[model samples]
Target: MKIGVLMKQVPDTETKIRIKDDASGIVVDGIKWVMNPYDEYAVEEALRIKEKKAGSTVTIISMGPKRSVETIRTGLAMGADSGILIDDPALEGADCYATAKALAKVMEPENFDLILCGKQAIDDDSAQVPQMVAEFLGMPQAMVIDKLVVSDDGKKATCYRRIEGGAKEVLEVDLPAIVAAEKGLNEPRYASLPGIMKAKSKPFKEINLGALGLKAEEVGAKGAKLKVKKYFLPAEKAPGKIIPGEPEDAARALVKMLREEAKVV
Candidate 1:
């Protein structure tokens, strides 16, 4: 079995951000980058699948600038068989669709039996790439997967999906499908010292857009179907007021505040 795992390098959650003067994007300077937190779950799940299937190979794929190789190595250290990085200056501002399209093209010839990704990248939180990639590859996709079971023959996959309001949905999907992993799917394993050393020798392939047969205008901002008009932070929220006294009094006060000061219903 061949399992393809998609990971991304994103600004660390704790990193302070500065918007560019033109609002085209955030300033990269002084920003620490790390693997997307959710993608860790995807990598862990793929490694578990490979462990269960003796001949299965887990390949981690990342798309970003040169620094993304560091993120890919992180996955290799977590036990993925190898890593592929699609690095090019043209891919700098690729949106979700372009990203998925490029990744689909890169893996189409690789012929993976299954694909996995994080439900969403923390930086953008768009939660759209998995579905876009599935569509581009013409495969069925299961999102927010918290549990997964592959058949002995590797022809089908049964999964439990986490839904809104703490609900769970069960799905039985065929092979050659994509799955977006959610939290609680599995605890991600830390990279052991030995594993890290072994990863240093793993095959890490880097290819440019030309190698992928993609032109500069066919990806990144030029090919992007969606556009961001402006980027700005939300206004600071006002501090809350406490309602004192008994339940009945507090309820009345809340109603008054909503009807007058807050003006809601």
Candidate 2:
């Protein structure tokens, strides 16, 4: 089986983000970058499937600035056979739809048997790309998959996913399907020294919008249907107020504060 996993590089959650002066985007300077956390789950699942079904190959794909190569390398180090980096200035500032369109273009010739992606990227949290990619490819798609298993013939797979009211739904899909993996599917493994060394020797294909026969107007901010008008840090949290006394007194004080100050009681 040839499985393709879509990965993304995002600012580390710990990094302090600053909006650009013009409000066009965030200032990414000096911010540490890492693989999207949710994507890690997808990669891990792919690796697990490869392990279970020996002879399977896992390829990672990512689209972003040059720095995103590091994110691809991270996946390679985790045992993905190879990677492709779709780099182009035109791809910058793209929203979910444009990004998905670019990915679909690149994946058209790969003849992949499966496509895996995170349920949502942490940076945008839009949760739109996977479905869009599936739509572009005209493939069946399963979202928020918590568990998965492939049939012995590798032609069909089953998945358990979360639904409304905390229900779990089971789906059976044929090969060449797209699945958006959720957290807790499996624990991801860290890259070892040997894996890292081998990753350096693996193929890393880089393609640009021009190479893909796409125009600048089809990607980036111009193609994005949504726009960010402003960006700013959230307001600082207020200090907590403590009520000290016996349980009865504390409860009374809490009730009084809720009724008078919060007006929620």
Candidate 3:
């Protein structure tokens, strides 16, 4: 079995973000980057499958700037057999649609039996790539999955997808399906000293827009159908107010405040 896991490099969740002077995008300078947290789960799940099935190989694919090679290395450290980096300056500001198109183009030749991705990237939280890639490839997609099992013959997948109101749906899908991983599927393993050292020598492949046959107008901000008009942090929340007095008096004051200050009565 060949497992294709989609990984992404994103700004660390705790990193401070600053809007660019021209408001074109976030400032990348001095910002720390790491693999998307949910993507980590996907990689771990792939590794688990490979452990269960003999002769299975896991490959990691990522599209980003040159630094994304570092992210790919991280996956290699976690036991993926190989890594592919789609690095191109032209892909800098591409939105979800164009990004999916580029991935579909490259994945066409790989012809993987299973594709795994995070439910959503932490940076954008769009949650669109897995579905879009499935659509582009004309394959089935099971999203936000917490459980997954491939049949013995490797021709089908059974998974449980998360739904609204904290519900889950059990589904059986044909082979070559895309599964978007959710948290709690499994506990991801940290890279050990040996794994980290070995990752340095893993087979790495890097390609650019030319290799993917992508047009200049098919990527970056120019190719994005959705544009950001403004980028700014949300306003800080106000401090809580205290209602002081007897229980009855506090109740009356609360009613008054709701009717006048909050106007929700």
Candidate 4:
């Protein structure tokens, strides 16, 4: 089986952020970038399936600037056979649709048995690209997959996913499908020294818009249907007023606040 996993590089969640001067984006000058946490789950799941099936190959695909190679290399160190980097200056500031369109264009010519992605990218949290890719490819898609099982013949796959109100649903789809994995699907593994060394020697193919035959107006900021107007941080949280008293007095104070100030009771 040749499985393709779509990965993303995002600002590390722990990094402090500041709104840019233009209020159009966050300042990333000093921020650390890492693989999207949800994508890690997708990568781990793909690796597990490859191990179980044996002789299968896992390929990691990422679309971003050259810096995104670091994220792809991380996946390679975790057992991916190779990586592809779709880097182009014109691809910067692409919205969900354009990004998905670009990815679909790149993948259509490849011989892949399955495609995997995180439920959403951490930076945008749009949760729309996977469906868009599936639509573009004209393939069946399953989202929020928490469990997966492939048939021995490799013609069909079953997936268990979480739905509204924490309910789970089972879905069976044919081969050449796309799956968006959720958390609890699998635990990611750290890169061993040998794996890292081997990854350094693995193929890392880089392609651009020209190579993919994408028109300049078909991607990036111009192609994006949505625009980021402004960004700002939420107001600081109000500090709670501490009430000093015995249990009865504290209870009375809480009730008074809830009834008067909060107007909840």
| Per-model lDDT | 0.92, 0.92, 0.92, 0.91
User: How well is each residue in 1-265 modelled by candidate 4, as lDDT tens digits?
Assistant: 8899999999998988899999989998988999999999999988988998878999999999999999899999999999999999999889999999999998898877889999999987999999999999999999989898888887888999888898989999998999999999988899788998889799889999999999768988899998888999999899978988998999999999999999999
Clashing pairs in 4: none
What is the Cα-based TM-score of model 2? 0.92
Q: List runs of model 4 lying over 4 Å from the truth.
A: 240-253, 256-263
Instruction: Give the runs in model 3 whose Cα sits over 4 Å from its true position.
Output: 240-265
Better of 1 and 4 by TM-score: 4
Candidate 1 lDDT by residue in tens digits, 138-224:
999999999999899999999998677978899999989999999899999998889988997999899899999998788888999
**Could you give the candidate ranking by TM-score, starting with the highest?**
4, 2, 3, 1
Q: How many backbone clashes does candidate 2 have?
A: 0
Please, what is the TM-score per model? 0.89, 0.92, 0.89, 0.93
What residue runs in model 1 are displaced by over 4 Å at the alpha carbon? 238-265
Which pairs clash in the backbone of model 3?
Answer: none
User: Which parts of model 2 have CA positions greater than 4 angstroms off?
Assistant: 242-253, 259-263
